[model samples]
Target: MKMKFEFQFPDIGEGIHEGVITKWLVKEGDMIKEGDSVAEVETDKVTTEIPSPKTGKIIELKASNGDTIHVGDVFVVIDTEGSAEEVSSEDKKDTLAEKKEIVEEENAGVVGEVISSSEVIAPSDEKEGNSASENVAGKALATPVARKLAKDLGVDINKVVGSGPNGRVMKEDIIKASKQPSEAEHKEVLDETVKTTVDAKEEKIIVEEEKIERIPLTRIRKTISQKMTQSRFTIPHTTAMDEIDVTQLYEFRKKYKDSLKEEEINLTFMPFIIKATISVLKKMPEFNATLDEENDELILKKFYHIGIATDTDRGLMVPVIRDADRLSIIELAKKVDEVSNSAKNNQIELKDLKGSSFTITNYGSIGGYYGIPIINYPESAILGVGRIVQKPVVKDDEIVKAWILPLSLSYDHRIIDGASGARFLNMMRELLENPEMLLLKA
Candidate 1:
């Protein structure tokens, strides 16, 4: 008797509704184990691996590479033991399979490609009717992340109790499973002799001409584009430009650089700006609020949690500092360093990017002197910090060199008026002008 399992698209991250399949690791008829990586999925914030849930032969692939699949949509089918030809012949004789194939093919290539054949087997009526039993046994479902986590942590998801809604296994379940010794007991169960070694002597170097293939944007990228378009149209944006004299701050940083270095803290100018921003946010609370559409409310957040926009090779990612107001300058600097490094390495988690009251983008680090940053939607304002340059300034009748740091603030007119926005900008200006104020606050 052969067992069939249909694996659905799992939740890749927090609040993620869908994902675009970037590539499939295995094709139909390929044999796969429970922990084998099956596909790569790109969510709004990250690209992650989707792993197999059961040990079986690939009988059918529901979605193709570059296809956008919603969470809970069946994507792949596996038969515990069977040839692809046998499965296809079985599917063709089933009426329900014919209808399902037609509908699936239509939606497959729209966002991705669909690979189909008559050899795939359709689930029998008795098996379809037994879904309730499968659900009860926790064999009918698992999210992509849950499945991946289970594999990574050496957890037996089938035996572990689920705490999530509908008895679904979650990340926590995998973490809990990691603490048990039994999880690793089956590590050497696979047939080691079946592994094939590469033949270096027979390998030949072949170079093919490079070709370019233009692929359409995945579902998450499309949604990001749409949201950015809506934000540009809805908000009447104006940039307020000013220069901050950060000479004193620069001197302060140099003096403490060695001390911070000894403690393994990379003291950058970002910490100074973050500390100053918190002080400024305290004076101008409106900049830290968001417009609540459902309640028609202007939600003013008294607490500060600043988001630092970090540009990665893939795209832009903004990870938030939780409770920026409560953290000391050193602590804030350390958090920024940790989050920025994680974002660059594609190791940042979904929860790290949520619930930010305001945002700051430091393009100055990369030699940009000025930029009009887009407001990170729902958040009322965003501050852009530019490069600090040494320029000539008049001091009482004489020319003197001063360090000037350019700043631009963009805010939503719906929640923050022009006057409020200007005041917020001025408050930030004052803090940057006198770096001592930041030390006082710290």
Candidate 2:
């Protein structure tokens, strides 16, 4: 006597409609406890594991590896009641039927919002329903966005495998599948079924064959594009570039490098730079403010939360350091190390990745020099630090060897002007050049 229950893919987050089933942790007949990981689904920004809802034995796997599952489709079926249970098969069936009737009656008006084909949608305030492009019995399942993206990319939605829940096609899967080589003389087929009003007169059309391959953007890449575009268009950007010598700053770090290493905190140039930026931001509050374009207001932040831009295999991620103004140089170094390590390993959480008064991108660490970094939107500005190179400088009335750092300060021209940006930057350069100023804030 076993009671079978199906588990559908749950809505992970807003705007996240589907997922690609990367791998299954359990096979059929494997006994699992409630909350045990059953499968890994790669979604936007995070690779999440679907957990078992109840203690049971997996009787059937509805999805295969690399399959896309939709929000409402069943992925696994489990028998909660064991075969040795006291209840008979007939009794279990009768109870299940009663439960089904109750569920159907309650969800009578919301059949389209089904979470599971056989199971009832939960009684929650949150809305549930697949997009219009959801696959029916004979149609290819896909989200409306996926279908539109496919059309834009000149791809056949049917050819793209849905990695979403219950084999539902997602935007990522469509983009990935479109990367595959097609026929040498392949021509993009337009979806003529989509209704559009056009003059009934004959129009000349030419199909240019230039051997072009269209690459679809990943979700992370798509997000980056949208954010970057918004930042470019919404804000009138201005860049302030300067060079500073860090001879004393280098020596200051060199003095305590061995001592900091003993505390398990790797001393990097970032923490020192962050401390200097924080001090400058505190004195110049306008630099750490957001311009409310809609309300015609500028909101100045009192607390200093600095965002560190880190490059990962997925994409560029910025994790914030809260209360950055309160931390010492050594503390900032440890925090920077923790966040950087977590970002590189992809172990950072959503909460840890958000909330920043300002952002700093150290392109210098990767050997880059002089980059006008786009301001992380809503935030007023972003500071870009380039490589520190040894160069000849006029010191004590003589050309001497010094470490020079390239700095690019890109800010919202609407809120921050040339004179203000220069003032803020000059203060930052002053602190960077004279490491003694760092101790004032520390």
Candidate 3:
């Protein structure tokens, strides 16, 4: 006896309630082994491949591409027996009814009804005896307009081949059938219908479309939009901007940048900035805290997990470096590279994206100068690093060239006042200006 199994879409990542079926790896009738990838689902957190739970022949795909599948919804149906031999018509009906019952029971209280595919399974020995029209009582599934057109042209709607979802007869199918030699008397009516159909289609396209191209937001982009909107609306934001003369710090980094590369570590100014910010966060506890609205309290984070805002092809992703305060500058450099590359390549784990006490966005490397970065909500503050440029400055009463680094610190004004925000940034400037001061904290 063949056993039918309905594979439900499992809970993939944390807090993932739903996912869009991006692609189908295996189609109906394809034999798949256990652990074989069946589809790629794009959730808000990540795009991951869903694997088959059992080795079997795919009897039907319950969900279509671009369909939103909720948790506990049946995604695919499989026949564990894996045999292509046809069963009796009576057995087929019983099997389908049984499968429908199982799907309804499993998906009860879920999003949509689990409707079985109308497409018949293949490898049947009989031809006309097992036809879909015969099975469905010789009724050709069609739209109302299609049925009307067939009647107008004196064409037998049931005899006309349907080229639509579940073998539904369409207007085009009727028009094609009417053009046949047997239906020679209906050519005049068919010509008129085709003209009306073409004109209507063209008019619909012109009416619905705009001059500009439209693109749908990806899963990550949509999540970013929602988060940014929430953070902007919920938090009272205030930004403090300043420029630090890091001439000595610039020379210091220039001196050892290549030497560190020998150890296969790509050193950037971000690690130095991260180290300096961590020290300042320690002194200013309010800046490293979250506002618990319900409790009416400030939750100070004892541990530092710095979120590094990185740019990738998908969108902006912040992969956190856990226990940031405990790592040495060299170790910070390595960790920075590791998490950044993982985020850029879309291989970073969901845990790495969470648990950040504070976030640092480096628009500097991308040539952006002084942006009022939004605070990653629940985190009290965010540090924005701008482009480092050289300018003339007074040094011992003499105007000389110095490397000036622009910084922007945006804080949650509800907890951290304007004065505290400025003070927090000034401390970072003091440490970054004097590169050696970072060594004390590192």
> Which one is best on lDDT?
3
When sorted by TM-score, best at the front, the candidate numbers are: 3, 2, 1
lDDT of 3 at 213: 28
Q: Over the stretch 54-138, how does candidate 3's per-residue lDDT look in tens digits?
A: 8888887876676667676566878878445323333454344322211111111100112112222221112222222632556
Candidate-wise lDDT, in order: 0.68, 0.72, 0.74
Off by over 4 Å in 2: 11-18, 64-73, 82-216
Q: What would the TM-scores of all predictions be?
A: 0.68, 0.72, 0.73
Over the full model, what C-alpha lDDT does candidate 1 score relative to the true structure?
Answer: 0.68
In the order shown, the candidates' Cα RMSDs to the true structure are 17.5, 10.6, 10.2
Look at candidate 2 and tell me the lDDT of residue 51. Answer: 91
Measured with C-alpha atoms, the lDDT of residue 26 in candidate 2 is 99
Task: Put down candidate 2 lDDT per residue, 104-168, tens digits, no spaces.
Answer: 11111110011212213121111224332443433445544455567865788766656664445
Reference-based TM-score, model 3: 0.73
| Pairs with steric clashes in candidate 3 | none
Candidate 1 RMSD computed on C-alpha atoms after optimal superposition onto the true structure: 17.5
Error of 3 at 205 (Å): 6.8
> On residues 207-256, what C-alpha lDDT tens digit does candidate 1 reach at each position?
23433232344443554565566567767677777787778878888899
